[model samples]
Target: AQSVTQLDSHVSVSEGTPVLLRCNYSSSYSPSLFWYVQHPNKGLQLLLKYTSAATLVKGINGFEAEFKKSETSFHLTKPSAHMSDAAEYFCVVSDPRASGSARQLTFGSGTQLTVLP
Candidate 1:
């Protein structure tokens, strides 16, 4: 079985400070990890993906994450938070090799991020 845990249900940060949101996962096979950001009433956008090919992955809007096998964690980080960055984030896990179309993705509950002035 595969599962993802978002450590925080909400995170608040100043406009210019660093941003950090934690996530951990457990998977039976080599899993494909992804981070997606969703603005209010908007669709989800792919931030990054770790496909067991690279440990350090970079994504859109200056976001990045490292895949840690020992810790079973893939934490999102950004050097400086922007007002536009305020949105809901999600950590997802899926076996790319699973039977079914590649479009099938399992999403985490979510973590709401607030960027304060």
Candidate 2:
């Protein structure tokens, strides 16, 4: 079984400042981790993913995350925040081997990012 935990339920940041969203995971086996962002009523978009290639993973919209197995963490960060970046973010875990009725993806509760002008 695998699970994802987003440390912050909400995070507020001023425009042009750095942004950070913390996340952790627990999995019995190696898992694929991802960060997804939902802008208001828009659908979720893939931000970044880690599948054991590089520890540091970069994504669209200037966002990035580093997978740290020792810390069990995959924290998302951006050097600067934008008004358009205000949205709800989700951390997800997936077992590539799972299939056919078996549970695959586990999503974190979610973290709402508020960008203040």
Candidate 3:
């Protein structure tokens, strides 16, 4: 099983600058990682996922993350911040041993991105 922790609870950035959201994870086996975004009062959307295939994963709206197994880190980043990017982001890991009763995703605390004009 694996679990994730988002290092930052909130990140404020100017609209034209870069954005970085840090995440760290621990797992007994190799785990599938994901980044999901949730706008206020809206459903969550998948940003990117790492399924033991690629080290670097690119997502919509110029976001990306690199999976570093040795470091146990999968951090999300973007070249620029936009107002639309202001949302809550979750770092998630798939629990490999999930059964009928167990939940599927182990989620991070979440990073709230605030884009300022």
Candidate 4:
């Protein structure tokens, strides 16, 4: 079984400041991890993903995350916050080839980011 836990339900940051959103996961297998963002009244867009390729993954909008096996963490970080960056973020865990499994992607509760001007 694979699961994602978003450490924060809400994260607020001032425009031009740094932003951090934490996430943790537990999986029976190596697992594939992903970060997705959803704007208000919009669909979820994939921000970044870690698929056993590299420990450090970079995403759009200057966002990046380092996959830490020791800590089982994949925290998202942005060099600076922007007004457009305010949105809901999700941490997802999925095993595309699990035995007898549907290969479903499980999503976290979601982290709402508020950017203050």
Candidate 5:
């Protein structure tokens, strides 16, 4: 079974400082990974995704993630943190080739990011 683990349940950063959200994954096959952000009372937004292409993938709002096969890690990072960035983040794994119920996505518990001004 494919699974994702978010290292931190809560992360606090000062405004304009660098932000890092750590994630680790385990899968039986080469997996597709994604980072998603959710604002207060808002739906999840896709930050970035990796599908066996590039190791470093860029996403919306200056967020980026690097897929490291050796470490089984796909951690998200941003050069600076903004107040607007305070939200819930999720690490997700999907098996694109699977069918039926097996194709469902596996999501991490979630990481809440707090941007302190």
Candidate 6:
């Protein structure tokens, strides 16, 4: 079984301030973790993924996250916020053991980020 929880339903920030979105996960297997960003009326884009290789992962749009096994958390962080960053973010988890024909992605409800002008 694989599941993810997003700590925040919404986040608001100024145009130049930092951005942070929290996520937690639990999986029966090692688990593949991912952070996806979705612009308004657009499909989700892969930001980064953790395949049990590295704990620290860097993603596009100046976003990054650290995988903490002890804490079971993968939190997204950005040094600065931009107006273009305003969108919905989803935390996803997948299990390779469950990746054959029955493969499916478990997504967090999502976090709506609002970048202030």
Reference-based lDDT, each prediction: 0.93, 0.94, 0.93, 0.93, 0.95, 0.94
Determine which window of 10 residues in candidate 4 has minimal summed lDDT.
Answer: 95-104
Better of 1 and 3 by TM-score: 1
Instruction: Estimate the TM-score for candidate 2.
Output: 0.94
Candidate 4, after superposition: displacement of residue 102 in Å? Answer: 2.5
The global Cα lDDT (0 to 1) of model 6 is 0.94
Residue 79 displacement in candidate 1 (angstroms)? 0.6
- Write out the backbone clash pairs for model 1: none
The parts of candidate 5 lying over 4 Å away from their true place are: 99-102
lDDT per residue, candidate 6, 33-67, as tens digits? 99999998899999999988889999998999999
Model 3: residues with Cα > 4 Å off, grouped in runs: 96-103
List TM-score per model, in order.
Answer: 0.94, 0.94, 0.92, 0.94, 0.96, 0.95
lDDT of 3 by residue, 10-49 (tens): 9999999999999999998888899999999999899999
Native-vs-model 4 lDDT?
Answer: 0.93
Report model 3's TM-score to 2 decimal places: 0.92
Highest lDDT: which candidate? Answer: 5
After superposition on all CA atoms, what RMSD does each candidate show versus the true structure? Answer: 1.3, 1.4, 1.7, 1.6, 1.2, 1.0
Model 4 vs. true fold: TM: 0.94
lDDT of model 3 at residue 76?
A: 98
Per-residue lDDT over 94-115 for candidate 4, one digit per residue giving the tens place of the 0 to 100 score: 8856655576889999999999
Candidate 2's C-alpha lDDT?
A: 0.94
Q: Distance from true position, residue 69, model 3, in Å?
A: 1.0
lDDT, candidate 2, at 51: 85
lDDT of 5 by residue, 64-107 (tens): 99999999999999999999999999999998678766777899
Candidate 5 has its poorest 10 consecutive residues by lDDT at: 96-105
